[model samples]
Target chain A: MSKLCFVTTGATAPFTALIEAILSRPSLDALLECHVTHAFVQYGTAKDVYETSAKAAREYLRQQGKETQLEIDGMDFDSSGLREQFKLVQDTKGLVVSHAGSGSILEALRFQVPLIVVPNTVLLDNHQEELAMAMDRQNYLIHGNISNLAPAIKASEEFRNKMSQFPPVTAGKERQTKSFARIMDETVGFTDFNNE
Target chain B: MLPACPALYTTTFLLATLATLLVAATLRLLTILPHTRSTPPPPRRRPGTLTRVLIVLGSGGHTHEMLALLRDLDPRRYTHRTWVVSSGDAFSASRAVAFETALAEKASRDTGEGKEEAGRWHVGPQYYTVVEIPRARRVHQSLLTTPVSAVHTLLRSLTLLYRSEGLPDLILTNGPGTACIVVLAVLVLKFFDLRGAQSRGKCKTVYVESFARVRGLSFSGKLVGRFVDRLVVQWEGLEGVSGGRAEYWGVLV
Candidate 1:
């Protein structure tokens, strides 16, 4: 069983920064054997980030004589192999870090990984920042800015031991009815009602 | 005047035929031309108390149509808010779109065997779960923690449905997201009215052919529209989409 730090999300600019920060950490890569999902690696090639980062990470691994394998298009959401991947994470107390896609986030939580929720944010305005802020404020998730991600990853372990202490879940739809309401009122020629 | 020569007569005949064809083609183009035209400006909207509309335009040309339609609506009578979604983090006019995620799911992370599914589900680079439903049924999808918070979300929909705010005099839609929400809102309001929910008045709903191919009384149109006071459209002589029941609003772009 291997302690996997999985990075399967696409080559969004923020995710690129996340991948770079994690790869450059002094002993962080050694603590958790890194395996990027094909997405980061493949598009990185087209984007050229993949070649540079993978080359750097691979070189470090070779110098250290560790044989942790890197995989592409391998992890599946619903296969015996997926379970094996889950087991690899769980057996070694896996740490799953990813973009803040709800389906992916829910699936990881359901799988019971020692989760490190790295919510994604655009380089510009903090859109995902608000979602991450909402979840983090309630203490339901572990997220931080990419600049502070390394420290945040360090902090996620303490959260691992305390996951059970939290309530079964802290959740509800806090009236995105407002978001959709704004959308509906505008589309249906009902703006006065919403604006009021 | 002398009797007209055959050549002159032939020229007159050709001119008449050309004029008639030109009119017919112009009418046809006017009928199907999507909601973006600067010519023959949209009618001056009536001064009736109007419904405020918030339109969320997706990551392409549809946003432009929404803008054009807004031009026809009397801004004072009917408040218009539009959010135009574009690629590469375009500034979301918080006024228009409340928020935006990537238009659709990206390709990758095919859990176990998701390669084919990813490619099939998305529109090229987009990644949201887009679907088609009737114009009258009402469902509210939002950016909240509980994807479907059964109690709170349901209660919110109920409030929006039976209340003065939810019960719009009319809801017309362009994007699938907006149209679907309008449809869901209609259904919820109707259910509540039957289940002892109060309503000040019945609301109207309109659907365009761009989003659906209605015909033979859409189960959705009929289902949601039954309680709805009216169902409207832009074109005349719809044989299927609305099942001949939708009121033709005369080619509203």
Candidate 2:
């Protein structure tokens, strides 16, 4: 079982769940491998959930007398180097979970990794809830509500199996491009190719 | 009636001829004044400079070009905030991810919706308009929630009705399709005070002409270029398009 879970959070993520997951790492020490990243702190954001999660994880490691090997660091997310982080996730042979940002999700998809998304909806009331609910509409994501995250991550048969699939077929749409060309030709109609 | 005054007749004829000629000359001068001066005044320097600008992205390659220019702004002096007025196409999710920017995508019937409504699926003004009704909008909300409702919603719904209301300031339009609208929006609010309209818009419009010509002479650029306060040609070559009429501040995003 490839059981490494790496999370790099933005200013907004499900921090309480992260704290809970990280704090309870010892309990699952024998069952799974965990790598929790606490990156949300550096960016002038201090939510109780993220702080608690980071603190709990640190305390748990200290109690167990084990060195904390989880990669927790500050990052400038708006920089170009952010792409390398996704590339790292791609190379890792394990379950992948990312906070819902179109970039991350798209990257995960490009790498063909099974991705579980925890939307930034905890910060606001938005259509993300609907998107999370509509997972079956397209095989893009498995919503990270967190309650089912452990089970889903441990055995996300749907996403795990479909990792090799390409994005939904867009074959017929090419004809539309041709039709669009026809309309353009009809309107502007005359072309002097010898404008050169 | 009293005596045949030959001197008086000649004097009267001369005076009448002079008066007629003077009147004709004055009337002719009046007609030419409006046309000769109708080229609009030369663009003037705006008060206060922009440090951060939020540009809304539209269909085709406009969104792509916008995302590309966003890569060039200095983070200290300017923060380029972008929101794509997008739809649920296969491209949206990928492009949104690629740009690493938040998208305000909604179920617009087509590109026309953004021209007048808050946020809709309409990709560009070339293809869409605002035709939303309450019942239809409710159905839209029920079916799709991705299309966001921001200040843009009210601005769009009320644009033509109260076009002089609160609208964005200094909209830096770079797309070929949305030119007429940017001009209309800028000119409409130019008469009245609105958000970002008077100051940033002292006709302060930023455009990259090479990026703009998706097909040919961007219709929207040509149209809106007439009124936008500052028309920025990203390339030195395109400075001619403004034809010495618009003020060129080198390459502006």
Chain A TM-scores of all predicted models: 0.58, 0.59
iRMS per model, in Å, is: 16.3, 16.2
Tell me how large the interface RMSD of candidate 2 is.
16.2
Reference-based lDDT, residue B130, model 1? 19
lDDT of 2 by residue, A30-70 (tens): 21334332222222143555555556755665666654444
**Residue-wise lDDT of candidate 2 within B124-148, one digit each (tens)?**
3222222221111222354354234
List the candidate 2 regions with Cα displacement exceeding 4 Å. A1-4, A11-44, A47-52, A61-78, A121-124, A135-137, A156-158, A164-166, A172-196, B1-253
User: What DockQ, between 0 and 1, does each candidate earn?
Assistant: 0.02, 0.02
Q: How much is the lDDT of residue B123 in candidate 2?
A: 26
lDDT, candidates in the order shown: 0.41, 0.41
Write candidate 1's Cα lDDT for A1-196 as tens digits: 3345554343323356655555554424533433322112213223355456656776776676652443222221221113444455666665666655433444455556655555555544343454455445545557655565565656666667665422232236331122223323343334344233
Q: How does chain A of candidate 2 score by TM-score against the true chain A?
A: 0.59
Per-candidate clashes come to 40, 18
